[model samples]
Each structure stands twice: as C-alpha cells, then as structure tokens.
Target: MNHDAYPDNYIRGILNSVKSIAMVGASPVNVRPSYFAFKYLAQRGYDMIPVNPGHVGKDLLGKPFVASLRDIGRPLDMIDIFRNSSHIMPVVEEALTLDPLPKVIWMQLGARDDAAAAKAEAAGIKVVMNRCPKIEYGRLSSEISWMGVNSRTLSSKRPPAPTQGMRLSINRMSVGGGDTAASDRAAKNKSEQS
Candidate 1:
C-alpha cells in the first residue's frame, strides 16, 4: 500500500468492512478532535470503544473508557490511533496481541511511524497512516461535500441509506461516479473564468 496517496476505493472498502473500532487516545473532553471523531463514528453505527487511561472510569459517548486495547474484551475490526507519531509503536504492538487481531491499524492525520507500520503490515494487518477515519467516512459518504467542503469526489448514485435522510455509506454503494449535471456546471464555470 502506498502511504503517500491511497485510492478512494481502498479507503471506502475499509470503512465499509469495519463494524467495530477502538480509538486509542480518545478523549472525554467535547472540544477535542478525538472526542469529535469518536462521536461521529459512533453515530455512524460503528461500535466505538474509547481507549484512554486518564478517564478510565468516566463515560465516553455512553461507553466507559477502557485503559487499553486489551481491555476492550472483544475483537475489533479497526484501531484508530490518536496519539503522537512517536507513541504509535506501543499501540500497534498491543493491537497485534488481540485474540482475533484487528483487520486494520489506522494512524491519525499527522501521526505516522514507518517502522511501526512496517511491523503491523508484516503481521498481515492493513496499515493506513496519516489519515482520519472520520474525515474519510465523511468524504466517501458525501457528508462533507454536502456541507460545502468540496470533497473533490462526486457520485451520481443516490446514497444507499436504507432510510430517508440518513448519511451515505459505501456498504450499499454498487457504483462510483458523479452527478453529470453538477460536474458539467462546475467544469463550465471554470472554463468561463479562464
């Protein structure tokens, strides 16, 4: 896998496949990025476990904080590391100890340790560095785009939410494309400016 640039399909596949996520360094504070990311994913229906020793007894998004990944007491599909790059190795090492082993190890944006990623990859687990699953989920689902974020990627297919007004997900996406009218409008606008 190229750490520099990941294909949209690669990321979409992981987001669709993973049902459970353990976020290491998750914070109970509402203002923190980890807190926001955790909440967003939880709302998206992924089983989110907050892994932080500082607030072990406190409740995080209705789930008690777990001090470590091993305390999750169940298998995880992915582990989102929110710690600094220097601190990533220990987390990945612990992730490898899980009974069933997590399928993917994702290092948060600005957090990447090549050596640690190598180790995880060697163990047959997929590794994604310097990316946020929350942002990836939003971009792929068009949630960000709808909010004027210009995700750059567009799809004509209606979001397969299974219900009205719920966010899109790759799980139900059979095809990837753009809304041709929107695409043409944007292209024409750019040409006129030039």
Candidate 2:
C-alpha cells in the first residue's frame, strides 16, 4: 500500500468496511481537529471510541474516553491516529497487542510513520497514512460539494441521498460551534434511528 498515492477504491473499501473506530489522541475540546473528525465520523454511523489518557473517564460526544486502545475491551475495526508522526510507532505497537486487532491503522493528516505503517501491514493490518477519515468519507460520498469544496471529480448525476438514519448534516451550527451537548444529542438521535 503506497501512502503517496492511494487508489480511490482502496481508500473507499476501507471506509466502507470499517464499523468501529478507536481514535487515538482524541480530544475533549470541541475546537480541535480531532474533535471535529471524531464527531464527523461518529455522525456518519461508525461507532467511535475516544482514546486519550488525559481525558480518561471523561465523555466525548457522549462516549466515555479510554486511556488506551488496550482498554477498549472490544474488537475495533480501525485505529485512527490523531497523534504526531513521532508517536505513531508506539501506538501501532500497542494496537498489535489487542486480542482481535483492528483491521486498519489510519494516521491523520500530517501524521505519518513509514516504519510503523510497515509494521502494521506486515502484521496483516491495512494501513492508511496521513489521511483523515472525515475528509475521505465526505469526498467519497460527494458530500464535500455540499460545503462548496470542489472534490475534483464531478458527475452530472447527483449522488443518492443518504438513507434517513444516515443523513449527514454539515451545517455550521452542528460542526463549527463546538457544542458537545448538541453534537451528542445529534449522535444519539442518529444511533437510535439506526
């Protein structure tokens, strides 16, 4: 898997197959990129578990934070790393220890460790480096165009509307304000509907 040029299908396949994500370096603060990414992925219907040692026992988008991936106590489909490039190796090492290891290791934008990615892939876990799942989901789903961001590949045909329970609301009120309570309620509503 070349991190430099990932084929669209390879990226889309991972996104479509993953169901649960453990976000390493997740933040309780709403303004951070990690917070936005976490909220975005959760809203898209992925079971998002926040992993942050400092915020352990605290809540993010209504889910309690765990100190580490090992504390999740359940199978995870992906590990979305929000930590620095220098920190990825240790996290990958920890991820490999899980009983039913995650199917993917995704390093967030600006976070990439070639050595760590190699280790994970050699162990049979798929790796996506220096990419953000939130952005990838939007781009693949053609939802970014709704925000006026050109996704480059255009089609005359409109993408199908997301199913009722899976509707995506990219309204500034829902995303930019950093309102956890509203975000949590929205996530809860989405889950119940699902």
Top candidate (TM-score):
1
- Which stretches of candidate 1 lie above 4 Å from their native place? 160-167, 171-194
**Candidate 1, overall lDDT?**
0.82
TM-score of every candidate: 0.83, 0.82
Q: Number of clashing pairs, model 2?
A: 0
Tens digits of per-residue lDDT for model 2, 1-194: 76665766777778878899999999988899999999988888889999999998689989999998888999999999999888999999999999898899999987778889999999999999767899877876667868975443445555467774384433111222322346435544553454
TM-score of 1: 0.83
Clashes of each: 1, 0
Score residue 29 of candidate 2 by CA lDDT. Answer: 89
Give every collision pair in model 2. none
Residue 65 lDDT in model 2?
96
The 10-residue segment of model 2 with minimum total lDDT is: 170-179
Q: Write the per-residue lDDT of candidate 1 for residues 87-156, one digit (tens) a residue.
A: 9999999988889989999999878787899999999999998778988888767677667765647457
| RMSD to true structure for each model, in Å | 7.6, 12.1
